[model samples]
Target: MHFAIVGAGFTGAVLANELAKAGHNVTVYEIRPHVAGNCYSERDEKTGILLHKYGPHIFHTDNEEVWNYVNQFTDFMPYVNRVKTTSQGNVYSLPINLLTINQYFGKTLSPKEANDFIKSLADGEIDEPQTFEEQAMKFVGKDLYEAFFKGYTLKQWGRSPKELPASILKRLPVRFNYDDNYFNHKYQGMPKNGYTPIVERLLDHANITLHLNTPFSSENKVSVDHVFYTGPIDAWFNYNAGRLGYRTLDFVREDHEGDYQGCAVMNYADEKVPYTRISEHKHFSPWEEQERTVIFKEYSRKCEEGDIPYYPIRLVNEKTMLNAYIGKAKKEKNVSFMGRLGTYRYLDMDVTIAEALDASRKTLDCVNKNKPIPVFFVNPL
Candidate 1:
């Protein structure tokens, strides 16, 4: 069977590779000229630093299969994403660990003392959380939530904590002990040559034909057995139902000598900062040598026309809009929705790749048996 895969990101690339390996012809249509989507990286001409074209993407995953699969394309360097936050003109370790708590309070707090202190701070009345703020307060109390999450959440989502769902807050951790590693994943690293080369190698197969700077038309389907759409669900149907909600990013680049923030990621957890975080590019690849460092001050806003979509903002209104699209999606015959935009959920690189692999396996099994493909590969709603 021949398949037409939309977008050359990990979703499409992985699907294309799988189908091609199964003796099926696969054609990938990428609107962007490059592969890897947001994780695309290449050597910068100005300073010879490998720039994360969209932003910084540090590959971290617990799944051994995913770790091994990614390693097939390029060698990976061991790296831990040690993140810090700048709030009220001071720097503190992220995840609200014991070290952060001690530093913020300016007291040498023991594990037992810190635990009891936090318990004292928490509001016991709100047993179940309905919103992001409530969930955060329940776990870490008000002071920490206000200092770290509240302002950043407001800036990132463009909504108050009461307006946002509790699930968003659950993604972030609140540690009782002092462990500053941002991700709790067992395996965390980066590609030796960068993400683009790895993605390029994934799509490199005899049966795979890539068409860059090309967009697929829903009205005119390519001559293939099935289509796997990694693009926005609303865009595929020409926004007939309604436009799906998305939060886009704007990167303000600044050049600095020697070092910028000492850490790779520094979150500005105050509304006064304007930008949510500043990602120092030099810190991303510690293996390289460069005197000057480039930092991208990230600003999140409501996705606009001709803007690169970064995060998905699935507020209540957006959920209603997404449900309508999913309804239409179920009735579709050939195409299947996969990945973050397709499912209308924010997925990290690990989750994204895991879903893609699962989707590919199920899709291939159905195709081989001449069975109907499922509407949603991984359910978001």
Candidate 2:
């Protein structure tokens, strides 16, 4: 069977590779000139540092299957994302560890003592936290919330914490121990060469044909047995239902000698600060040495037409529109919507790859059984 996969990101690339391996003709269309989408990385001309063109993407996951899958393509270097944040004119470890708590409060407390202290600071009145602010206040208390989360959340989402859902804050951890590793995943590392090579290898199959700088719109008719779309769901229908809200990012690149922030990622948790985080690209690839460094000061804002959407602002209004698009997507024949943009959710790299793998398996099963292909392998809603 002939299959069409949209966007040459991990989603499309994985699907194309799987289908091609099954002896099916697979054609991938990537609007961008690059293959890895947001995960695209290249060496800087001057600094010779591998720059994450979109932003720093640290691959961390507890999924052993995903770890083994990615390993087949490129060698991964031993790298743990130890993030730092600058808040209230001070540098502190991220995930609100014991060191951060002690430093912020000017007290050297034990793990048990710190846990009790934080609990005391938490607002007991709020029985069930609904909003992001309430969740933070209930978990880490008002002081830490204001100092660490409030300003950064506002800058990242361009909205007050009160307006956002509590689920957003649920992802953030507040630890009593001094473990500052950003993720609790078993496997955490960056590709030795960069993500682009992994994707290139994924697409390098006999039956797979990759088309760069080719945009696939719903209007464009293709002669394929099935279509796997990884683009925005609303875009597939030309925003007939309404455009789903999204937050886009703008990176301001700067070159410097030696280390810039002395860290891979240094987030600014002050509202006064314009950019949310400054990522030193050279630090991302620590296996290689470089005298010069390149940094990107990332700015977040409302996504507009032609802007590369990063985070899906899945507020109440956007959810309604998303459901409308999902309904329309289900009604279409011979098309499957997958990936972060198609599903309209903020997904981690591991989750995206896992989902793509699952989708490919399901697609093959449906074909072998002579069953109709599903509009969605994973429920978007």
Best by TM-score: 2
What lDDT does each candidate get? 0.86, 0.92
lDDT comparing candidate 2 with the true structure: 0.92
Candidate 2 lowest-lDDT run of ten: 216-225
Sliding window of 10 residues with minimal summed lDDT for model 1:
217-226
| TM-scores, one per candidate | 0.97, 0.98
Q: Cα deviation of 32 in candidate 2 (Å)?
A: 0.7
lDDT of 2 by residue, 1-381 (tens): 999999999999988999999999998999999899999998777777888999989999999999999999999999999999999899999989999999999999999999999999999998889999999998888899999999999999999999999988775598999999998999999999999999999999989998899998655445888899999999999899989999999999888888889999999999999999999988888889999888899999999999999999888999899889988998998999999998998899999999999989999999999999899888787
lDDT of 1 by residue, 295-343 (tens): 8999999998788787888877888988899988988888888887788
After superposition, the stretches of candidate 2 with alpha carbons farther than 4 Å from their true spots are 217-220
- Cα lDDT of candidate 1 equals 0.86
